[model samples]
Target: MKSLVLLFATTLLLLSGLKSQESSNISLIPQPVSVARGTGFYQLKDPLIISAPPQNDSVKFVANFLSNRLVNTKGGWVSTEFSESAGKAPIRLQLLPKEDNEIGKEGYHLSVSEENGVLITANTSTGLFYGVQTLLQLLPTAAAGHTVVEGVQWQIPAVTIKDYPRFKWRGMLMDVARHFFTKEQVKQFIDNMATFKFNMLHLHLSDDQAWRVEIKRLPRLTEVGAWRAERTGRWGEFTKPSPDEPKTYGGFYTHDDIKELVKYAAERNVTILPEIDVPGHSLAAIAAYPNLTCTPGTYQVSSGERIMVWDKGTFYALQDNNLCPINERVYSFLDTVFTEIAELFPFQYIHMGGDECYKGFWEKNKQVQAFMKKQGLKDANELQSYFVKRVEKIIQSKGKRLMGWDEILHGGLPPDATVMSWQGMKGGIEAAKQGHQVVMSPNSYAYLDLYQGDPIAEPPTYSMVRLSKAYEFDPMPPGVDSSLILGGQCNLWAERLHTMRHAEYMLWPRALAISESIWSQPAAKNWNSFISKVEHQFNRFDAASINYSRSMYDPIFKAGKDSNDSLQITLSTEIEGLDIFYSFDEMFPDQFYPKYTTPLSVPKGAANLRVVTYRNGKPVGKQIKMPVIELKKRAGIKVKETP
Candidate 1:
């Protein structure tokens, strides 16, 4: 009881002191480039204003926002000098490029100085628009009661700012094959990537569930794999039939659709990397061309129940699984498939599915063993390595690089091959140590298919990894050279994710948190600070009508109450401006604006205290799981007998 009293007192003191210091401790510096607590705000002081004459409405509008942020102080001015003759101007502002002007074509760039005014330019309207976003970040945050318009506030600061990204390959990966997303949805994703300054999107187009891209040479590849009659069972158990099966599900992109998406992504400076699995996740291939298998037998559209050792569809027969008798027909089939891939995707790197190839087939086949002896291959695992090497040569000969799951590293990876680390950092670490580039997408952090929260609330998957864990990830493990870390990706493999809503449910707000991890510097990261940003971002998602998991906010924000008398809660979601309302008596909550403080109070004798999140006078999105709280205090005081 005595210890409990002391602990309560300590917590109360700490929270009180933090609250007192909150305002004064806020840095007076221009924009805080660190993790945004709630919303990232910028304030301007003096000698920074946009005074340039108006060109297009977009240019002028963007300039106005920048001027407001850089001149956020009580009195300051920023002028944009827009003219054909930018003579003797300290800063020159231009609009969408005319064939001759080169300032804004690629994206937005803002050059600022304490002595001179700020100049901003972009090649397109959107570029200038993004420059404004950067300028706002460079300014100062608004004080209490400042009005916000369209998610931006005018709190400008005076200073010189020069900023840009360090690497050109900042990227993320999305798998639409497990569950197909429409072209429009893909474009929406491109827009989302643009908001965070991410520059690449690796699309895992082909998987065992479905094949997405259209290959003209092999029409059935798309006809059979691109669309499935009905999806298989859940991730772990593939016994029961899918209850909500679509009679005919799946779709593929036409050549024109691909071209449009390519142009769209290029406009946003995002390169699309596509993956086509081979050798093993080849049930899709066999279904399309039964002749590709060693047995040359009939194959069905995979029900997610693949034969581990041998099947009529796979190269190794059920009983005669071995590499001894090298199959001439299988090689020819693979050659044609690779040739088609080389023609379809212009990306330098191509993913060949090299994971989960069961060795049981080879162990049983005497012909395979005989061929292995003939070729002097040591063991079955070594044979898999040889298989990968052969494919690597095929991809390399056509001027492309081969990328595979870290499983490819099992037998022995070719020097030229790259690996996507999914199991853990071990594959990436080994690959980098051997002078090969690696993309870290470890499942502990990057697997988005796993429930972002408790399975009781959100149905379960094979993994229990959460969203906050994803945000806390550091791509390069300690002691590993960062040079070998090419980039990172959050993989959304669809096993339970059957529909587009399920896809969005698994991705959103979580992917938003990950965007900062990949783009922002390490020192700028803070779990608490990010939650504040998400509060407002949640409103943004609502405004966009994106259907995401409601339970995801718990761990990311740590919103539950402690056993102490008061609610010692932490707002972990990145949304800003959330009004937290709570009630100990369970009647309803007393509203608190921007409720990111600790140890909230509930009415006396309150049995339960629950909080609801709101934005802008309305419930922003789904209500979170209320944390269990108690109102008991210490029992240390003793009464005299006379009393």
Candidate 2:
């Protein structure tokens, strides 16, 4: 009799452990403000009914979206149309007739129970959409797969989550200029970003490398500038294209494409902000219409080749790319561009790229020099400022606002122009101090193109921005008016990303950290908590077959010299519970190899260092090999470049 009692008790303990595990998994990204995890699960049954309060088409769309996604992803029989009865397995999407003070504009209150099914309520349809996103996340990761998932007992843990974004602007910049991404690819990007609650998309439509959007009034902009000779390899190191090479490696979006995209993004609650680069980075534009430049000479659109030469570390332009700031025709040309742009994109802010304006061509032009002296412009900065002011007026004429890079503040800040600080926080802070709006996108903290892990383990880029740095960013820097600051985003430049998969790989996981920084309360953020959620997110990405970087799990190499003046390599990781194994010999290292317990000093004639990470005696990270010569370079020692 005692043995029977013991067996029953043991069974109960195992069941309780399973329930506890289910109760603990509230790993939603952009961590919600409040969460109450409960025991048991809301096991989904067939004939699931998604009920909603009768309302506008947007609200209906939200309800239909949930049902359609379930059917598409899970291959389940789902029916929409709910009632006051709230029958078995009822998922209710409620848009409150009155506002819930706690659940403000983009926030929602979500509650789930095994007994009552699911209840998602919000003050607006957008909030309802967000609540649905969280609801979807609560399901098994495989439920998100592109192909229909079979034999899944669709279930969600019973929980109560109240969530909202901390900032009004959560954005991502897709640079389609350096390398054009198709309209469909951009749509896929929008879908991914909306999952993380990013509300804005900055479309970089023009650059020296290529033009990515159609200008109906300027046919040559697409006919001549939209195509470029094929050139691959490093962005700034590729050789010049020969005359025999055909310009057939690029494409542009038509006006109809923009309209379709704008509508599609709006449905996902994403606003598209179009960018038209000017003054600088205009080689493609000048290549199309040579008269637009200060020195109107025939030029071809850059083929991803080096157009700037480095003199000791500083860069100087080798071509005339900047728009002629003093030419009347330039303003006329811009007026036409802005007119079409303002009509195509409904977003209030238009980004007039004022970054990297090379003044050499302007300074050398006799006409620009004459105009500057006549206007008493002190320097090239003032001349550029003059150009910016005129562009501002042009933008204003279209019933829009001008947004430019922080460089616009050089000679003087444009009144009412929003500054996007890319160089660092100084420009953003300065702009906010001057009572102008600012979006903090410093390359140091928010450039997605930067390497997210050790250089040896990741693709080549000029520098690194580990996941920790992205999470640790403070969008609301001290000493600036919090009201003037308009949140932040990560800029993903595509000079090296030739494929959509590569772009996606460089974007996510790190973007997840940025989302949390911008959306969650500062105090609510805990790196330990966020990283765990990130691991769970990987499961979802896998199910969706979307590419993402696991760089966080890889070892970060730091080089230094020991007291004996010998080379020393220090290794660490971003996530916890991993054992690092490394080797000094050429052989590959695994869990059985030497465990990393301390910094290692280079032994004599050790040519290569191999490293890998393991958890529970199994390899869990990529095997990375670092050559001794590369380590010397990281240690600030001069190493000969391999020709």
Candidate 3:
């Protein structure tokens, strides 16, 4: 027995040594372009040095940022030196004189070895920032924490990596209008995505529920539009505001807050694209100034429920939220809004939301009809096209290009307009075919608001977008000019996300998948390998105190009735390693229970079916319990029980 124990201990030590010696399996989230493992590791110890080219403030800033991060994580003060020294420093950031055209300006070459210590070279500051992010990832996951974490080996694997993004416009859109996220929350989001090298932050600042950005000229836009009656329970199921009810549950970003956020994102190499949804999804604006609409009356800000009526083959929101195209006052309102938005955000494009403009009101109103007839407009679609063209001019006057949803393709495609294809890739393909630049944000894959795992086990959302599905998305569709594709983005519509925690739960792992999809090359994609990297990021997220879902561990349960009228249950998971187990009795499943090998039928005399997932003989996911009656309901068959 003593000899057997000695052998076991020896084997464990051998395995640990083997793991340490093995070429660093650095599971980078968005895999770098080229990585070659070296012989030695860079041990991060006291008095760690970081040097950059003299007078290079950007590199200096990065060094300081890293130094502070190390101090916070490792519980020690590590000073960074920006000036050139006689002795070689552990970390060196150098700016290359000539850019590598193939790698582009946002690419960097990183090398860490015994001979050179650690070296990062890039043509631009943005590239350097990304390189720093990659370097941080190379360190121990505990280095991501805010407080000091003991018993961690602060070491980075020695390697040489040449990395660059496949697309220039990787982004994430957060809708603050439906549910407001605090300025600090937004900054936290920006920081998280920046680590994954996402370059654009699309702020959906206005929608039917609320207006989330302050405009000095239009104070009521926030006073009346931003503040809505406090909502509880499921979205769209809230009680309607009564005469005595107070509107007290919403918030907006002050101009100062916006400026601070802009600066914060800019320093991280992220551009903020602010969307003041226009012509449609404008109920919040209409609530503030009712005259902007064709039907003039007092309009209360929506309490998170849309007023809809079944129209010609479709449902339409009947609050007359859409701006009246013929009303010059409407255009003036937009102009003022855009003028303020343009002054606040420094991005090149302003998203003029041209999606879902229910033209039912325009079709019904006599004055709008007369105006349309005067202009020889064929339908409300043409009227919307007219509205878009005028708004395009307004945005152009502010020295910004116009971007909108695919619904803008209805009447006629606006020239110089960039289309964000949200419905699906069909709009993106059409826009690319017409030579219009497009951002592919197909709802099927890019909508983070959708359910990632089984809706029963996870939060209630409309659709399923598994991590694999998100990873499989190719923004540049076949037969379309790839050059016209300005990369892709994942959108988190905040209707279902009541808190920052809920938003974070929905964004990660899947967002990690999106980061790889948009940033890594198409040829470099490997689903199995990406899943491994995602697991590594989960640890980093844990250290950072960020909320992320582990719903991927849950098995997808499908129920159906066999031809013999017996209820059948099929269970599977997108992740490869999990083993599904089940028990018909009320007790929890264990290894002793039947391991799911085939379609499971309802056991005789069983009252309920319980399913659980395990990894390496240990339970890892939520145990799912479904009643026999519920299974019958799902299978759409009535099973009479025998006494």
Candidate 4:
């Protein structure tokens, strides 16, 4: 009896000692694992070893092969998939296929164990794809330009992780309808999506401004509407017309182009959701087929005012025009257009932009009023609902679901439709409670066209959406049913943006923050930490020669590092990659001052400090000055005036 007691106690002591050793090894790992694991996931380090049969199925092989190929060897693998001996590696992964699971219905099952091999079973290829993405997070962060090469140096960090996205439809919307982006540009956007693990790209293909995709049945639509006159001016400069009035504008994607884009996106695991704006933002379509309008007329060809064009004789001089009321010809036109679009995009959802259908035209037309009465509609809003329902039925026949802006809920929403909550969170909550899926893209946070920082620092565009507000956007609103939330997207309205560089300036640095918000657990959100990651990404962008705006250094306060000499402090803080020097006293005539040794010292009790920066012994930019004390510290800690 005593011997048995001693044996049991010894076994307990052995178990405890083993656990302690495991804890110490794991302590060497990062805190992110603690957070990820607490959420019930087995987080594995990058360059993970997935043990499989000597020869596995293509899907499993592909999953592991991709991780092995893409995992950043130099940066440390946060996510990876490779085949090798497990006992010697930090993570031992095993891929197991479920026998009873139906094809295309597989999902990831991930967990960690004390056993040598970790089993990860999936029922479909898609499950494996998602698992690869989760593996990416477990890998370490690399400095910009560092590629995950085969062998150099690899670290086996202790981590067990399991993760899956809450929303399956996380997305981003790119409006090619407003101004066409080249096929290469579209693919570039897809590449960016892959970097952030974004799974969907909602392509807004048609709008009032132009028609981007090609329909073999309608050649003239693209040949004409796609190319407008000169582009609009900078943001807010929309009102200004260029002197080069006669210049033409536009481009479109051929059927071949679209097929290629879809294939490209598919390879990156991104589903492209194409949007066709209906009823209201249909001036371009109306122009293509004037007979569809209640007021059929020719468009006065001109530059700069594509947003507002009228039936030549109806509303003369004032410029703005409305979508002519629904007529038989209009429905027929949409039927033909959608028939072709449905064939091209096989996705379950089709975006029928049901927003901002002004009432002026409906009120003005007697025919519309009579049609409304016959259709049992009360007012223009109800008529709009009827229009959406009809389109929804047509789309349903094609085996597709209808998605529209929040305005579709006005008067009445289609029962079979999903709502994109752009106006605010309330619409999403309302839609979800009513048993519909919602994509929350509130303009205040998701509108990328909004400037990223202070107006003075950025270009003279419209006001900017500060970085913090974007970071705070929660796709899943509190009290909102989780099942109803489809996902969210960031919209970059290009009304004022023209060149690709301008597009990059508006997208980058900022989009990085949005990506982290949507993909990373929300609790891990920190603007400062996000800024650091963004800076690292900027280095990658720079090394790739991708055009992007440089992050500005924070201005030094008069009481901070610049306290010695206000003028020198100001210059040092203001300039980037330059040295500053100045002199306050009249002493040392013809004296040479070292960089950062400027003599223009701030006076004691001075309210501001001044500084100038120089490169190669010459002043290239203007001097700057800042206040001595900050008004608020809770707002954010200021970046060091010196970088």
Candidate 5:
């Protein structure tokens, strides 16, 4: 409470006014390229006028959006109207007058002056939309909340900001195949990503779990493949569904829904990249048409039971999910699927997921072996690559390019394929060196589904990617061809994300770092400055009822064994200037508790530890309690005893 209030106070002081036209500390996510703040302010009051050019529907849409936001602000409705012209309008949104502009095509120049009120200009409407986004962030902090508050004033600080994205393909992946998100939910995602100038939304539309896009000719694709039995616990541990069990869960988007979502995203300048995972992760499709796989039989859509088990760092598939590599029918099925997919999505690149394919089934099948020998395919990897290459031709036949996970670089790399690197920077680097266009989404840096904080303090996921790592991500590797590297994205695999609230919690804060990494110049980034901006964004999220993680403030505990084999503990934080206080006896620790200054050995007879974090003598993080045994487990030690 004290920390937020202090942050608010600091924000007020900074936003109130500035001197010498310096870059003031106005916290905007995906920090603008350049900003010069001027003294004084522009007070926005009732009957605010927004002027846009007549017959320019795009400008009108942006203007109306700003008007609505002002009217719906926390303090109450601020009456606003639109007109073709208004003398010195309170707000004006439009494109630049000339073909040659002051900023990039997707860039905008926002000026808030006392004389002219607020004017945002760009080379395109998309740029103007981004400018309005910055303009909204400039409003008084008091107006940041979904609920109404009386006696609040809307004051716009005087500043000029020239902003442009650092890369063209600023994107994020949402795997709705595992857990279907409604059309409205997907639109909400578009709105959130668009706020930070994310241009692409990779919709993972199908996987082993379920298929999430409707095809007109293949009715069973949705009838039998789109749903599964409800699973209540963690992923990969749910009990197997009975053969007759009713598939009461899951959903897919109709053609109309897809069109509506595409329109909604385009209005906000976001493109939808629909993915239909193939060759592998195709249980849903095989469930609909058993003949798609090497072994044809009745197969149910995954109900969260373990399909592949990991042992000794390698996965072993329990069922045959990979599509038949040499089967001609498989290509026909994919051709039909991609034909409708190409018609529905105006975006050029259709993502064909070709990752984590289990090839034992193909290697064992006698017909597959014979076909492989006939084609001169050396191994099962080559066969899978052959399948993707065949699918690539189908995609290109529909006048679309092929994009897939980094695994598509197996036995053969498609000449025109765009690789989305998820394994790590290695695959991305490999592809970039080969002159392929790449989007670096390595799980090590950008997997939003991974735990951002200590596993004990966060929701369940097998892996972790810290916020610092996300901020430190550089889409362009040190030795790669920078031109072939088309920015990057963070992915939120929905296996464990059951609701939009949880998804938002995992995506934001971390996604903000990704946005800055992809949209802001690398030299312009500072960790401390970025954290300050993120803290400020929390209020805006609250105003709009958006969920986010405060995990960065939580103390990260590390346990290690001393020379004597006793447990030694250390505490640190993602954000600087936080003080960690601890108690060994398990009583709730507060600011008065002993502050952590150095590594502390386990105290005699202590059963557990309690800790909390504070800054400026006010609690900023949730109090955490850790049992002594948990500490030993954290240290990867067995047969632990209290030191």
Candidate 6:
């Protein structure tokens, strides 16, 4: 009898362990505000039905979207019904008559149980759509696939969730001017961002490299400026375009394509903000009409690098790329561009590229100097300011607000211009103090193109911005009024990203971190929990055919000197759940190798050290080899031996 009791107790313990594991597996990205787990699971049935209250097109659209997604993934038709009895459907959407101001327009409540099946309620259609997103997240990962996922039981843990975004503008900026992405690729990007509750897509349509949008009146802009000579390898290593070289490696979006994308993003509640970079990054525009530039001559569309020459002090001096502010035709050209831009993008703000204007040309131009003197401008910054003010009036005439980079804040800010702070938090803080709205996109935290992991293992980039650092960023910096801060965005500059896959590999995981940082409350964030959720999201990404980097799983190697002046090698990772192993003598590491529990000293006379990371007893990531001399050199110690 005692033996039987012991066996029963052991069985219960095993079952309890399994249940706990199952609960942990339901990790959701950008975790909901509140979740109440129930005792039993809701087993989804075949011929599932989704229904919503009548006359709510948004709710109806959500139902149809889920139904079609289910049919595509699970190989079963799910019907949508619109009727008063819709509340009885397995999946139901409800819009509360009175809005709950606390939850706001984007918040929702979702409940799943055996008794009620699944029910999502919100004060608005946007809230209902968000609730549907949370509901889809609760389902099995296989449901994320586009094709049939066979042999998987569709089940959702019984739970109730209340979720909402913390900020209004959760955005991502894609620099399409440097490297254009296809319409389908942009749509796919929108789909992925929508899953994380992002609502704004800032399309960088024009820059020094190329112009990526078609304006009906400015045919030469696309015909002459949209194409550039093919340049591969490092961004700044390209040779200047020769007269004989064919400009053949760029593309632009037509008006119809923009309209189609606008409609598609609207269905997902994403607003497209178009940027026509002006004044500074206007080489492409000048290439189309040389008269627009201060120095009028033939200009070729740049491949990927800026024109620079070494000054007397050895600092790189940039050549003139600014539009001729003294010319009356410049304002007319800008008016035409803004008119077409305002028609294409319905977003309120148009980003006027005001950063990196080489003031040398303005100071050198005799006409510009005379205009500055006539206008009582003290310096080149004020001249740029004068230009910005005129552009602001032009943008205002088109019924849109003007936005620009932090450089616009140099001499004097435009009255109604919004500032995108890319250099650091200082510009944002200053802007908010001045009672102007600011978007905090500091490069230290929000530059997604930077290497996220070990620079040696990841793609070459000028700087590093790890996942943890991005997660730790708070858009509303201290001393700044939160009301003036318009949330933040991650920028993906495509100077090095030649393909969509490369862009994807650089975006995700880091983008996931940024989403949670912008959406979730500060106190609710825990790094370990977020890492676990990231691991869970990898499965969904795989099912959805989304490419993402696994660099977080790789070990980050550091070298430092000990008190004895000997070099010590330290290994760590941004995420947990990985076992680090190391081997001396340049051999590959295995599970049997010395498990790294603490920093290891470089062995005397050792030539090299090898490290590998493993998860769940399986080897993951490439074997990292560091020569002993390199380690010593990194530790600031003299290398005894040369490689």
Q: Which candidate tops lDDT? A: 2
Residue pairs that clash (backbone atoms under 3 angstroms), model 3: none
TM-score computed on alpha carbons, candidate 2:
0.96
Residue 186, model 2, lDDT: 95
- Model 6 stretches astray by more than 4 angstroms: 1-15, 306-318, 562-567, 597-608, 627-633, 636-643
On a 0 to 1 TM-score scale, where does candidate 4 land against the true structure?
A: 0.69
Q: Write the per-residue lDDT of candidate 4 for residues 240-354, one digit (tens) a residue.
A: 3344444267788888888898888876678899898877666666556666556656652233453443463233223223444466666666677778888887678889888
Query: Each prediction's Cα lDDT score?
Result: 0.61, 0.89, 0.87, 0.61, 0.87, 0.86
The residue pairs that clash in candidate 2, if any, are none
Would you list the clashing residue pairs of candidate 6?
none
Candidate 2 residue-wise lDDT, 1-643, digit = tens = 9999999999999999987788657788888899898867888887788988664678778889899888887776887884444445479888776898877988999999989889998999899999998898898887677768777878889999999888888989999999989889999999998888999999999999988888999999999899998877778878787766799989999999999999999999999999999889999998899988878567998987878765764667998888989889999999999999999999999999998887887888788888999999989999999999999999999999999999999899889899999988999998999999999998989999999988777888887898999999778999878999899988999989999999989998889999999999898899998888988999999998899998888888889888867788999888889999998888899877899989988888788999999988988889999898998987987777879
Model 1 accuracy (lDDT, Cα): 0.61
Residue 20, model 1: lDDT of 51
Task: List ranges where model 2 is wrong by over 4 Å.
Answer: 1-16, 82-89, 309-314, 636-643
Candidate 6 per-residue C-alpha lDDT over 1-643 given as tens digits, one digit per residue, 9 for 90 to 100 = 9999999999999989977866775577787888788756788887788888878787788888888888888777689998766657888888877888878999999998878899888998888888878878888899888988789888888888888888898999988999989999899989888888989999999988899999989899999889999988888777788977999999999999999999999899899999988788888899898899888677888887647543553433255667889899989998999999999988889999787777887788898899899999999989889999999999999999999999899899999999999988899899899999999899999999999887767777778888888898789998878999999899999989999889989998999989998888887788999888887888998999888988887888889978887888888877778899888867788899999999899776778888888988998767877777777777889855635
* TM-score to true structure, per model: 0.67, 0.96, 0.94, 0.69, 0.94, 0.95
Residue 609, model 5: Cα distance from true site in angstroms: 1.6
Roughly what TM-score does model 3 have, to 2 decimal places? 0.94
Q: How accurate is candidate 5 locally (lDDT)?
A: 0.87
Instruction: Write model 3 residue lDDT over 496-521, tens digit each, in one string.
Output: 89999999999988999899999998
| Model 5 bad stretches (over 4 Å) | 1-25, 74-86, 100-102, 142-148, 640-643
